[model samples]
Target: MSIEITVSELYDLKETIAAGLLEGLTYPWEALPKIHDFIIDLGESLPKDIYEERGEYIWVAKSAKVAPTACLNGPLIVDEDAEIRHCAFVRGNAIVGKGAVVGNSTELKNVILFNKVQVPHYNYVGDSILGFKAHMGAGSITSNVKSDKTLVVVKGEGISIETGLKKMGAMLGDNVEVGCNSVLNPGTVIGRNTNIYPASMVRGVIPAGSIYKKATEIAGKREGYF
Candidate 1:
């Protein structure tokens, strides 16, 4: 099996409480279904002084900034110093990591956001795992369900893996930058430090440290002081 989309390959597990759960797991998407239960379990162990249990199965850290207009559902945890911006709709089963930003009008469901991840502005992220410091620009959305409603499949060059899930979203690795107005099709797995251009319709697996211009036009990135 390829290591490109694996938990160890795409993420720094030390940045998330799911670290222990991800151990020995090959793929990062394997943690998606278990997020709700994991949050419930982790929420119970959090210090009462730091995190407040809000209604059933919801824990919000005392220092986190949540706008009054934000609609937050249950089985969710907004970690310390996180920001839930205006009008954000979090529809449960989410773990917003520390110092992360769930920005204005963003909608999230059944997702695990690693520490410092930013899904700011008009975004819909569902059934996905975003690695640390990943940022989605304005109007970017993850199209979780296919029109046919069949099980989602992860497709790569010369390989296809069945997920058995009707609703699956994009998996963004650490420091991945998705530009404005982009639509990430279901089962899109972008590797670490990749950048998708604005208004792009992205699908399948994009390798790490790449700049996705189009399906046939991916470029390697050079690191330097710029």
Candidate 2:
């Protein structure tokens, strides 16, 4: 498919504090390895009145609600109005954006969740960049690694990008809605406003404004209701 799923195409830079990190990169996945050092550098600049340094290089916005049971590691930023719920595990190199929700049992690693993004309930997102308002349903997860442990390659019809990274996950564009119990395979990229059906096994680049019923059936939003 001939599509533009670049980082700038998929996300609004205004939605995340990690915008500076992504701005220097072309593809969203390119930001993964840099997230660790980026978070450390960015966290230091955050105003003390707005955000508090909790642990080693971990910044939590005063307006954010983080449950006491949540486990947070270094190089993590929880932005304003974000909610890190009970038993949430933030494994580090993660940014929980403004008004975003990281619900119970959700695990995040090396991910940038843009404003209002929600990965609530039984979700595991790693080495991914979720755009503004993207929402993953309960039990949905991003499978970041290949079984054989080689580099991840983003693939779509007429498109192939060799990422040259062993760990990479889904890239969900703005307002994308991933259905429940779905598994987004490594290097998956869902474009803006796309919706994947429940229990779907999705990989490759799903075009913007499409409804993915299955691997064989992808219909534009105008064709049917989600």
Candidate 3:
């Protein structure tokens, strides 16, 4: 049997409380359904001094910066030093990690952004988990639902993994960089230390340490220069 990409290999659960709830799951998509409950539970445990409950299950850290125009709903936690920029919309069940940036016009829902992650500049990230320091460039978005409205599946090297989810999104590993205007289709899994080219439409599993120039043109990391 082929070795499946476990959650531990692609994410550090300690970074976000919601991610920790997915301890035994093999795929990241499995955590999508549990986000709402996880946030509600974690929000109750956050320290009052560091986090402030702002109606319902919405908890925003004292030190986090949120623009007045931003609309944040319940079951959300914005960690310390994180920035929710102008016009940003956080629907619910979102844990914006420490020092992360959700920039102007960005929309987030049911997502866990690990520490230092950036979804800056008109991004739409829903039902996804962005690992530590992962960054999505301007205008990039995660296409969370397929046109057919069926359960999402992840395909790898001649192997298929059924996610049994209708609203799955991308699972971006640590240090992954998605370029401008890219669209990560439902059930996309981008491994660690990978860089995707601008305007690329990506789907399926992209292995670690690779450079994705396009959906069909992926290359290994480059060797050291002279």
- lDDT tens digits by residue: candidate 2, 76-194: 99999999999999999999999999999999999999999999899999999999999999999999999999999999988899999999999999999999999999999999889
lDDT of 1 by residue, 113-138 (tens): 99999999999999998999999999
- Candidate 1's C-alpha runs over 4 A off are 1-3, 223-226
Residues 17-114 of candidate 3 have per-residue lDDT tens digits of: 46667788877778888889988888899999999998899999999999999999978989999999999999998989999999999999999899
Q: Could you give the candidate ranking by lDDT, starting with the highest?
A: 2, 1, 3
TM-score of 2: 0.97
**For model 2, what is the alpha-carbon lDDT of residue 180?**
99
Give the top-scoring candidate (lDDT): 2
For every model shown, what is its TM-score relative to the native structure? Answer: 0.96, 0.97, 0.94
TM-score of 3: 0.94
For TM-score, the strongest prediction is 2
